[model samples]
Target: MTSVLALTAATAQADAFNRIASFPTHLNNAEANAESSAEIISATADGMTLVYSDSPLEVIGLIDITDPANPKAKGNIAVGGEPTAVSVIGNTAFVGVNTSESYTAPSGMIKAFDLATMTETAVCDLGGQPDSTAAAPDGSFIAVAIENERDEDLGDGRTGQLPGGFLVTVDVVDGSLDCDTVNVIDVTGIAEISPEDPEPEFVDINAAGEIVLTMQENNHMVVATKDGVINHFSAGQVDLENIDATDERGALVFTESQPNRLREPDAVQWIDDNHFAIANEGDMDGGSRGWTIFNKDGTEVYENGTGFEKAIIAAGHYPDKRSDSKGVEPEGMEFGIFNDTPMAFILAERSSIVGVYDLTDPSAPVLAQLLPSGVGPEGAVAIPGRNLFVTANEVDLIEDGGVRSHVMIYELTDAAASYPQLTSAGTDELIGWGAISGMSAGAGSTVYAVNDSFYGYQPTIFTIDTATTPATITDATVVTRGGHPAQKLDMEGVYFDGEGFWIASEGRTDRMIPHGLYHVDMDGNIDAEIPLPAELLAVERRFGFEGITRVGDTLWMAVQREWADDPENHVKLVAYNLETEQWGAVHYQKADPDTGWVGLSEIVAHGDYVYVIERDNQIGGAAVTKKIYRIAAADMVAAPLGDDLPVVSKEEVRDLIPDLTSLNGYVVDKIEGLAIMEDGTAWISTDNDGVDDSSGETYFWSPGKF
Candidate 1:
């Protein structure tokens, strides 16, 4: 029996740095603040910190963190501008101040503050402007991601070019407040990493004095010199299991043995100046556990084996638990593997568990620990000084009351030391009103969380916790999105380009019916909505879309078509052109009378190719060959829709893509959705919404001919 003394010992020690404290509170997992944007700047040993966007110059809030137990309110910084990125360097704080009432472009300001004096140090005027900023360790340089006035229109309503933004390095060598041209790294020239498109997110930089690493949201990392020179050798997709780049020359050395898919890379950290860890929120629809590890040279060091493999192994060992526990939906991750083993602190989105992995052995890592929390946990950061791992609980608020948003802190306990297990260690919930989505760390260890009301009934953007002086969460100012809910339901994923975000809303309601694609600006407003035609909208019981991908201005959606006639009818693929607003659909067809498609689950386009996940019709009472169809987009567009209506026969589709019987692995259940990784690999998900079978699982399909 577990004794009282043992239980007390298992309890986490109260550290003034790691404890959870409530300060500036608001709505959570709610619709009220739909379009609200919150981001975590940094986490410290004394207390955790954050920053949120409100409106005007009152858009900055400061919270006190002297006591981890109770985070007090320090005050507010009236920057009189809509702040975008919040970072702190020494006694000075930096914020991306926008002039527009909402988050538009015309003018912007780079406001500097003396955290000690709590006064503005300097302000620089710029256009298009800085989206995100990273301060140099010694306070020498501040690298800002800037774009030439957002130009061009991507059907979705956002105005950034194919590779819109550029990186501008500001020289802070002299304490001059005057604005002058420093250095700029033009991203417009960078080749599209993925054959499909490229959406790069500049992650963390190495603390090493010389070299800094910037990782993309889509999983590409580029090492740059302090002078803004790109180390092309160190740039590529994060595919390996483990990657460490600690050499003084800023050389990226990786594991050259085996390679794998590096899911959605949301965060990156330096292990010790060389070795680093990447947080991959594995693809849900694609059935990847998400997180993986890579060395500096772009080789995969550790991977959460394909989703199906993990499920198979888990079921083999803990069949009972496997039957109930939905596998990990990993997202933002920080390295802190339990029991002195190489581990990762994974943000499991769906299960809302902080999953710990023991990657002592890169190839086959074990599920170390899983700390439970509120719904839809996204980004996470490991603050070793505080012995606490924090996660952004970005839950979707579909119900009226709204699920509470959370900035959760979990104290790393020794319970796993004596008995290293994957379990919860209790969490301290902080202020969260709207769904807290994205998170990042800035100067001064200030943690910033983005509270995005993407799918809420109302849209607003707010900045919480302005300065690190005392570390208090202050709502900088409130920026509203015209005050109308884009009515986006089940908003699942969020990607920040510094300028704003391309948020993915997994619309799962009859109200919105099928689902739609939306764009929310940095200042909390629905810039525009790109939706499918009424035909694509899943009727009473029909097709529903879940996944989306945008390349340049081109957008692709993966929609699942339900059997409308006999429950055994095949599904169709709908492809829409963001430019001309043209729509084209391809229905599944099979030559064999018995091997017909019951449903068409997912659609993904890369280069000139397009792939679709097809659900199989019953074969001998069991699903056989749920295939992935690779068709040329041009050919798809050329396919006749028959008198302006989408209708295709099984035999016609069979003729379009030959050999349906010769695909890779097979799923015996309903294949629902699909998503493509940064590395061109495909991940598919299954739905058991109706079946009594526990066959609802995800699978990873490698890049190959089907």
Candidate 2:
């Protein structure tokens, strides 16, 4: 078994990064309905202001980090086209604007804005579509990666689609760009894979006036000096073993292997003048699922193999759905020296995690911490002068009513890491778990929880030990049928039945998964399946059973939303008798949502009441109701279905908004699991939607006596 002693003691460290604030990108836009994003962020010389490229809004957003704990929006400036990247030198912000007409006819420019006046000061025609921009440390010149990125749909998505890309270097004096001195460096015949198409994805300049660039699709790297002389090398390849290589399989199996995988790096940053690090975010055929450190002479110093992805898996942040592709997709990276210690921050695009590593010994870097970001962290900026680090998350989920793109800020201090409130870290085998849907108290301080349909092919029951500071998942049991993992189950609720457990599967008729109750032994072996009766099935909707609780010989199930036969704002509390095998129901009134629909998420029977978690479908600031209400156990008399059921009265037990926002993140929509112990200690958790377009932040906390 993996040793828990070290993992538990590691939490006592006093030096770590802690998130302080999050600023939504939409706040910079004048229209609330329009979608916005924060990508490719850069900080000013004073390290008090932040500027990010917003491609969807075609603008560059500015934020005042004068007070890093509570960032304020400073509005946006139109870049006239899609803003791809931004870099701030002194008080001026240089943005790369993409105005591509087609893959064959790519066009872009570099627009410099005076942040003090919020006005465009200079515009230099880049002569091709640009992907990334970087300013020299000495402010002598600025480098732009003219990507002329390939059209994935054309020519089988290869890089050799012609009209290849190059690099541009422009002189800068007194914080102003001299457009007349723009120099376009031709970078062709560089790599054997795509010798004709050089798609430079990212650029970074060191203190020695040398520029390092990554041609992502071509799988090559180029180091250009001040005189425009270039030294190019192939990014090379890696052999991957013990990884999950199948996509959409609904399970995480790491027995697969892929040999000779290309390290098609995306983002590169110089740790010093002689060495640099590259995030191997492969495009088509590779993604080593790690970062690499290399010398200026093309000698590989260190290759992280599957170590980074494995760490993410231990933190329950692995994107199992993207297993077949670039797992975790480490895309952006930043290097800085904080407290005299060199550090490297690696951003995982798919996992939404930022790995902070201490480069005290360049050859042997140590992972310090893993901080959670918004949905997709596209870029990061580290300001050691202020002991601050920032990430620009580029995903805007407005269409799904989810949290918008955010710019998360973290402060480096002598404090313990406040994140990763829950983990399966010390387990003997890696336990990849998320989307915690239902929970029930087991024997003593133990609790049993089940994952939703996100792991449909590997439905599991996790055993948690809640005595630790951050609860630990001690073991996992796969809910199996005929010795095989049960399939087509969207388990939403689970209840302890004195021996084993009774699970409620929320059905989706469209997906061929039916609504039912399952009886499983302690080992998670499905002994029986009980389908919903015809009387309830006739009125059932996709939002069926959400929670289950047992009292005496009756099983109580909370229906998620209103059904066809139920009154408006009223859902049924279904009851099933174990002795008589009869079904009954009771009406439970819920508050009407102001924007989205309100529904019941969890149900748990306590000493004198049945506690239910009532929530709305809306997330973030739009959420109206996230509460727990209790119904008197004496009022749980069930009436036969197909008749007017007695409406149960409820008393507000707690408003979960405070607990949801306790970590400073926006309110999540899914508060789907609750487990109350015999001592009245209640534990609650939120569903992360299996980290699919979600922040992948599962909040598990105890509200004390309920």
Candidate 3:
């Protein structure tokens, strides 16, 4: 069954996971700019606290989740090595730390710490690098995946390197980790590929004291108890059709194929004693781009195929840059039962989203919801007793001056799913969309939106029906030339006139994309193109027209940043008289940046006022200038382009930071789209940066009347 988030808000309200809070990992460190990550996460026995492996900080971070809606930073403790995975039994935390000197001679330790005191209690030498750890349900023992991972630079990056990996079982004596009772079980020579060097990726123990293991690089799987290996099988391969198999081309094309793609499972979780699920996040040779459920005997009970990736694409979270390697990259899996329903949480690593699958029928699981996540979700834990679920995002963009990693908390309640504030889930085809730059209120209860240059080859005008609760994209009209996808267009602004549209293209002369305007008919055929005048073109920078609005016979455009001739913290509101064919400008004073440069992103004229979205390049806690400002329509008087310009007075309409963080996510930087309808309702949206170096979250909402 090809279902991608088929549940609507009305149907999902019976029971659903809604995000309540986002805690930044850097908050645990004293330094504000410290780089940290929340990789593998586990909850305490009481489900009142959480612990996660932070590899970059060489520590394990702790959080007090007694109040799931307001998680507090319990601080991090130095483990003296790279913490790769963690699991909690009772009040003690078991952390797998990699102290490997090199890939040829792997060395690791299972470190135990008291969560209440944050002090080291014990350490067990594992003699190999550990990747994942799982605690038994009854607190009897713990399982660790000893992945003596191969060096990618060495040879073809295959798994058959020296010092093959194995499994370690540690007995929990008296409800605590007993390092002296550590036992090793050989897991080599069990699979068809790279049997000598079995790189165990993840492990999960069922109630029957059996461990389910996935050797990702070796393309193998195994089921073993403390005694020895019971069963083993190849992860096998899949034949995929209608997938985007090309990367870094700045487009979304899903007509390619990967035949016999290897299903290199990365993370596995036990659905029950007889069955388990694995996320097929491949290594070097393959990534099936989906998840699968398997019986203990290695028989496939269900395989999602391309259904999960299709849902991510529809939610505008598709990472086209990783398409050739893995589409959406399903890397983490969590199984939990909340309110008498078995649910599976599948995380898309590259897309930064979680696919909620209702496993009422393990053989025919249904895609129930898709929740937005922080960038690069690597681990997840479910506390069903408290009706809660959590995710540890591992990507920290400190070097890129972006948002830090975060641990997001979600609670199951009788309320609608708040994420995917906008979606194209029910579209006819796979309408892949992102980087929503501008919008215009269309006729009736509809809105017209446009994607920026991220999808350069697929310039589109999206028709959104606001009549729905979260709004829905009903149609996508591709702007074309001679019946083919247009070229050299960086559509940043769009205005839907009664009969057609006027689009603005931001210039990047370095990339051969010119700064200009286009007049198109309703059929998306370009009727005319208008280039910038010599006066404006000679003084242009990378920042150009961000939005456009029509007032009588004059069309006004908002420039993103100040040009050469503009004053400090002042940008031009360029205007073109359609009847006179003349160009002129008026100045709009913008805010002085507290951290980074601030500028305008959109402009919309409604009634007797003109609204604009002014924001800064900073994100998360560093954000300050995301707001809406308006100017009286009577104050917009344009002067000659080469002469002195008059500055228009503006009033602060609204502060958008509150609404931006309403969904319990890090504040995104781009507040690009704004639409004002005839009923005094104004809609606002943020750009997802085409899911590159971003959380792939687009916040679309209405501030009532801004």
Q: What overall lDDT goes with each candidate model?
A: 0.42, 0.90, 0.90
Per-residue alpha-carbon lDDT of candidate 2 for residues 205-298, written as tens digits (9 for 90 to 100): 9999999999888889899975664688889999999999999989878889989999999999999998999999999778999999999889
Which of the two, 1 or 2, has more TM-score?
Answer: 2
Q: What ranking emerges by TM-score with the best candidate at the front?
A: 3, 2, 1
lDDT of 1 by residue, 509-594 (tens): 55453366666676667687677555444342434543444444445544454434312344444455667676655554532335
Q: Compared to the true structure, candidate 2 yields what TM-score? A: 0.97
- Scored by lDDT, model 2 comes in at 0.90
List TM-score per model, in order.
0.45, 0.97, 0.97
Better of 1 and 3 by TM-score: 3
RMSD of each: 23.7, 3.1, 3.2
lDDT of 1 at 676: 44
Poorly placed runs, candidate 2 (over 4 Å): 1-10
Count of clashes, each model: 89, 0, 0
Candidate 3 wrongly placed segments (more than 4 Å): 1-12
Error in Å for residue 626 of model 2: 1.0
